[model samples]
Target: MGIARQLVHRLEQWFELMGAEYAYMATDRSNEASLRLFTGRCGYSKFRTPSLLVHPVHSHRLRAPRRATVVRLGARDAERLYRSRLAHVEFFPADIGAVLGNALSRGTFLATVGGYEWGGVDRFLACPPASWAVASAWDCGGVFRLQVRGASRLRRAAAAATRALDRAAKWLRVPSVPDFFRPFAGWFVYGLAGSGGRDAAMAAEAVFASIVNMARGRAAAVAVEVAAMDPLRGRIPHWRRLSCTEDLWCMKRLGAGGGGHADGWDWARSAPGQSIFVDPREV
Candidate 1:
């Protein structure tokens, strides 16, 4: 805990010197040690519970909404979009250009309509953290395929019942456990942002579908992380909630400035905030 405080303090000081407004971090709800270190000792406050949902590539194609048009975005276009709309996003990094140039990322995409507006998604590969640590189920984002078309009535009924239970658990504010896989690798969609109201949202669905289709060709699953306040989430219903982990987003204010809460804002101190947008890489 002492080491964590020291490391975080130094990093925060550097970010403060760089003129950043707030510092952000994220971890699983199960990680009590990290929660305590950041929230208790380091003065960070939990803000959002970003869910990691996974799905088969084919599923995205099946669920893609009609009239939605999406386009692949090069790094230059992606960076421009982020800069122009930074005001609408929370917990975003000022150095978006470097983030786009990151070698770890596969590519970035944009969802648009009539060439008037765009939304971007940065894609990354979920590599094993370390060699000794074996691959787990979520490493592939939990693949799901719908093939009840040729199934017997009994089999179809069983599948329906299972899905119903999953929905029920979600409504109760819990996760539907994921099937873990060994030695898995796949694509992870990060930094999804959309504006332009319903027009932008509809286009976002096609963008997600494109990622899903690409993953399908590689025989891998794709995962997307987003907060509840993100409107684009309501447009994509094909992704399944992973019961295995919940992204606990935490933040802490830097200097003595700012309005409302001078000491800083703490999400853990009250109900989850209605708005949240912590980038996955920051966590």
Candidate 2:
């Protein structure tokens, strides 16, 4: 086996020891070798497409509205906001627990209005403070979910929360929130966004604005890996500004691939399979 294949084997073994159900990796669609390595010998089945959005610390330009409030999120409130997010979207049963755990972790912020939680943004902040924060807003625009409860109005709430973050970013003058997470400085926003409701499109736009504003407040630049083909989506009339960094692929292993479901299938006896892979970064 080649070096890459050996490395993948080692990784698979390590993850298996950690009780991983299946292992997967993401690579740009333009990278034919990586595509082959994962699909050919790694035993990952293509599942769905996912996109990555990135914002640099210097490209932020949107301005926050005149008035807004910013507050740090407490653990309890953060958990509540996380639960609310879970209620709004559909997540894979296998990945829900891990996702929730990460969301409620320390690197999260909740945006509220009129003393009520309106939207929450969570990011993974660790070393490389420059890439410190990669956040996602719960409600952007008028749409949040199919069944939103309580007094929080989607669009208005989202706008208020977004504006607050923008203001914070401006006060920090870092050019990007994610960059703040890095110790040495210079990072950007990277993650995914999806909306489900009557005003999904509008919500998406608000998400974009909020993201840009947050970046600009830090004096940073933003790059989005958009799945939408609509001309109105993203920075509007400037789609090329964002470059494609990687193509996320959904890889699935059939019939008890791992995670306590592997008893029924015999990996040694089955024939290897292949499927047409598509870029997940589109949406």
Candidate 3:
């Protein structure tokens, strides 16, 4: 605790000199020590808790792949797309040029159909008024795998019970993941979206299926993050009923505020698991 406070103080001083407006950090509820240090000493406040959902690519999750006119763009084109289409998205980087310039953004993709196209994000009100979901895989084969493998004995046992129940559900012809939960390497479908009635959504789905096929043997799973309120949340396929952690966002406003307090921030009052968002590059 003492060490963290010192480190945070130093970082705050550094950022202040750099003329940064605010500093952000996130921690799950289970991390009591981290929460205390940031809130108690660092002068940060609770902003919001968003559900982080992941979709693992597998045979079962391979729903019908619709065919849409999809194009993989170059760095310059992707950067242009981010700049032109994603300005109003909440939590989006103000300087997308910096983000696109970062080495982490391996590639950019765009999907178009039915006279509509989505380059960066698919925003919706509470839920998308339309329908579409994307599929891809990531080469994230280490920590993500470790998380599930390193579960406690009790936690593993609970998973076993769930597996048995899953089998029973499948026997009754109900929707269930009969294979338990197996994982592999995969790609990610980030900033995938669509609009303008059924055809457009279907086209987006087709494009996603095509990507999934490309990742079939080369990757273990693809992961994407969506807010709970995102209409596409229900449409995106994934390991059904999967458990995930919720990260509570904490932030401190610089010189412009009341000792960097963030209690009254609009994002703080948002419903947990709602409006979860992630840039594909951060996937």
Number of the top-ranking candidate, with lDDT as the measure? 1
Model 1 over residues 21-139: C-alpha lDDT tens digits? 67878788999999989889887777678776666433223445555554566777667656664535555667766766665455666555543333233221122111100000112
In terms of lDDT, model 1 sits at: 0.55
Q: Residue by residue across 251-277, what tens digits does model 2's lDDT show?
A: 534334343233755332333221111
Model 3: per-residue lDDT, tens digit, 1-283?
5887889988888998998767778778788889888888877878766555544434333554344455566666655555554555567666656655555444554555433344334332223334333322334442243233555677667756654564455344323222223444445555554454555456555555555545554554455665545554454455645535476778777665444335564443344543333554454
Off by over 4 Å in 1: 1-23, 29-37, 58-63, 113-180, 237-245, 254-283
RMSD of each: 12.2, 15.1, 7.4
lDDT of each: 0.55, 0.39, 0.53
Tell me the lDDT of model 1 at 222.
66
Highest TM-score among the candidates is held by which one?
3
- Sort the candidates on lDDT, descending order: 1, 3, 2
Q: TM-score for every candidate vs. truth?
A: 0.58, 0.48, 0.61
TM-score of decoy 2: 0.48
Deviation from native of the Cα of residue 268 in model 2, angstroms = 18
